[model samples]
Target: MELAAGNLSEGNASGPKPPAPEPRPLYGIDVENFITLVLFGLIFAFGVLGNSLVITVLARSKPGKPRSTTNLFILNLSIADLAYLLFCIPFQATVYALPTWVLGAFICRFTHYFFTVSMLVSIFTLAAMSVDRYVAIVHLRRSSSLRVSRNTLLGLGFIWALSIAMASPVAYHYSLFHLEVSNQTFCWEQWPNQGHKKAYVVCTFVFGYLLPLLLICFCYAKEIRDDQKSFYSFMPNGQSLRGCVPFIRCHTMIKNCSIIQFLNNHKVN
Candidate 1:
């Protein structure tokens, strides 16, 4: 009895033991990250599936058909998007989920480099497609001379080379850095100075955004103007919908192409 009382007293003296803490989640989760993850997942699924289908269809195109230049441009675009979706999306999505860069220096640099390269490839390919369309529609006779498999392939090679070269600076500029306050590491660009950073931004803006925008806009605008003029001249004024049908049919192709190019450029930017 005495020992039992002493044990009880000892237990009371020690006070109630604290409850074990609930296990922490493997990763931090919040509304913002949750939404981002969901969005990335959807994009990954749809983008991968769509791009894969396009590539497969294009690859299996009727043998000996000599795929059109537009098809070639589209194939390159799909390839670029596939590369972007495959390589960049996974790493990029991590930025929202994690607070630090855990992948190390090489992946950091490569991801950034390839991100820019893929984007430029897609954008440039869209620009090339616009030019091809302009040539095919506006200068029909010349298109026969200008649009050939060899030239399309050469253009694709140039786009890839230019993208790789232009994006090379990113690989050199990006590196892993430690944050003393957070005790975390981050992948970021380490420019030599503010001026260099500004210059890079300006250059990227001009080459990646402005030039492509100008080229696409110019090609489409000219094509539309020329088509409108041709349509107006072909159809008598005050004619029936039958007369309007031809213009509408012609404009529909241009409109669809414009929308597609604009959406692609928007995505790249």
Candidate 2:
């Protein structure tokens, strides 16, 4: 006992022992990650609920009542949004919450693939809807036969097939790999060259955003111009101009919002 005590005393005397590190607080969290998770959770909940409702209403239309072409487009849009919410949000949330990807290679690929596919489908659907509206309003007599259910269904199928084909590169490029230095696994696109990666980003932005945006804008602008011409002729003393102000402003606001959202989403990815 004495020898043990003497040894303990000598050990203590060998300079004051370094202080022990304080235990981490039990409730501690990364504030940024916490906030991100909360926001993503809210988005996922609202998106799923809203899209599900839209799909349900569209799907349950009374039997023998022919579905409108617009309803078909909206239904397709809702399904794409639902798919995005269900398949993409959880995995994307994990990206912000976890330090490294724990999901396997297939999930990593599928998540990115489906994300791109859904985004493309959504934007393309919007473009198609804009064109349909323009045709119905501006070229009514000329395009009457083209705006039928059969054509709409065919168009929706084409959209899905094109979206899937366009998003194929993501599945091919994204992969899970182990990093020796970080001692962690990550799911990322492994491009052969930096230039190729940039090219792909540029290509996706152009096809997914730029082209669709231009098409929507052109269709709406032409429709608005035609409507305004007829509307002004019917109204007295420029009353039509006043009436169009609010609509023009609303259109501008919506356009700005869409642009902002697309930019933000791309930045996040």
Candidate 3:
């Protein structure tokens, strides 16, 4: 009986364990992903159409005519956003709809580079437009000549150059890598030194955000103080910036809230 018991125990030990349970499919998430993809697709579609309209109108205007400083900055900002809507948004929708990074390695690098550059350009252009408004409002006599077409073009060029310089470093660390375990590809910044990424973040925060924001605040504040004295001072140059009335009004209001208050300041009404 003892020998039989020992043989039975050995047989039990040698018996195959139940096969490991299969990985469960994430059922509910597919529905969520589909919703997300649809929303992004709509956003991408509308953004492309709107930005293209702005671009076409601005680019088609007479070459030699003077572009307003505000117009110039808006044009540049639109271009940046256009590039983003064209490249990044569609790719995002694709990834949300599918399981893999179907756009490939080259696109991984290119998209990130394009995204960073466009973001930098948009912010820089906004800060520039704020400066233009400040100058236009605060130092009307002093800056009127400076706001002319030649200078506006130069300012636009400078903004583009600065954006390129600031965003160029993002490309250095950006790359595509394949994961062995997942058998998948991803875009990531591969900085040689661990601190390199931290350094880049710091730089972007300081120059891209902090410094530009502070400068905008300082300039706009100065404008507010000066603009209080001069109300309804907008003298439209011959060019009307075809499709930019609403855009100009919104941004200009931020810099010239003092001008807005002037309506209340008037006792005549």
Candidate 4:
């Protein structure tokens, strides 16, 4: 009877149990999403208005007039900024607000592609602007032929084409994934692979931040050097124009007069 009870107890303990936990909760959506929507909306509005003004100013100004390369850069930067604000930001805001990509699979793919392309183009254009400034100030003589308007346009076109190519993978991989949670349906990226996320972050930092910062630093350094040389060469007759002002004259006269009075007082003593 004891042996029989032991067998029964062992059987009860080994009875079928719950299965292991399955993959769940691929993404999170919450109040922060609402805040993101508001912030993105404001950014979109301001970017659109500012870029539109830049475009209008660039278009109304005459072309082929040997304008500053900086102006051309501003025009192209405005175009890229406008594209991001108008084409990308609204779609992103919608996605964040809905918390599920209600937009179809095609839109999901294309929207991601468009956002990436705009981002790349914007940064590359800024880099080009830095290079233009560097050439203009560091090698002013050589810059005359190199900084033509047509060349700037061509460079912008190339930047756009390269950006599109870089962003093509986004169109290829993105898809909507549906999940079940307590009888509710949730949609998110089909596969949030760690490797892909890491790659994206690294690529963004390299192209978006590091490279552009280096270019900006180079441009500013060249500008400072050129300005220093120009200023030294233009100084008048080994005397600083800044130091030869009426203020300095008055101070010098007061010092000389005080010295003369002190000398007279000493002689009287």
Q: Candidate 1 — which residues are off by over 4 angstroms? A: 1-27, 228-269
lDDT of candidate 1 at residue 139, scale 0 to 100: 85
- In candidate 2, what are the lDDT values of residues 85-194, reduced to their tens digit? 89988988888777789988999999888988887887788889778777766876766587878999999999999989988877988888898999888887777776
- What overall lDDT, based on C-alpha atoms, would model 4 receive against the true structure? 0.63
Task: List TM-score per model, in order.
Answer: 0.74, 0.75, 0.73, 0.65
Residue range 76-159, candidate 4, lDDT tens digits:
767776876777677767766664566677776776677667667766766786687677667778877888878998888899
TM-score of 4: 0.65
Candidate 3 ranges with C-alpha deviation above 4 Å:
1-29, 60-64, 229-235, 238-269
Backbone clash numbers for all candidates listed: 0, 0, 0, 0
Residue 133 miss distance in model 3 (angstroms): 1.2
Model 2 TM: 0.75
lDDT string for model 3 (27-125, tens) is 434666767877877867877897788878777767676656666677777787788888877775666666567687777666666666676666666
lDDT of all predictions, in order shown?
A: 0.73, 0.75, 0.67, 0.63
Model 1, 20-70: lDDT tens digits are 986554457666677889998998998899779978987776667677675
Q: For model 3, state the Cα shift of residue 183 in Å.
A: 2.0
Model 2, position 269: C-alpha lDDT score: 29
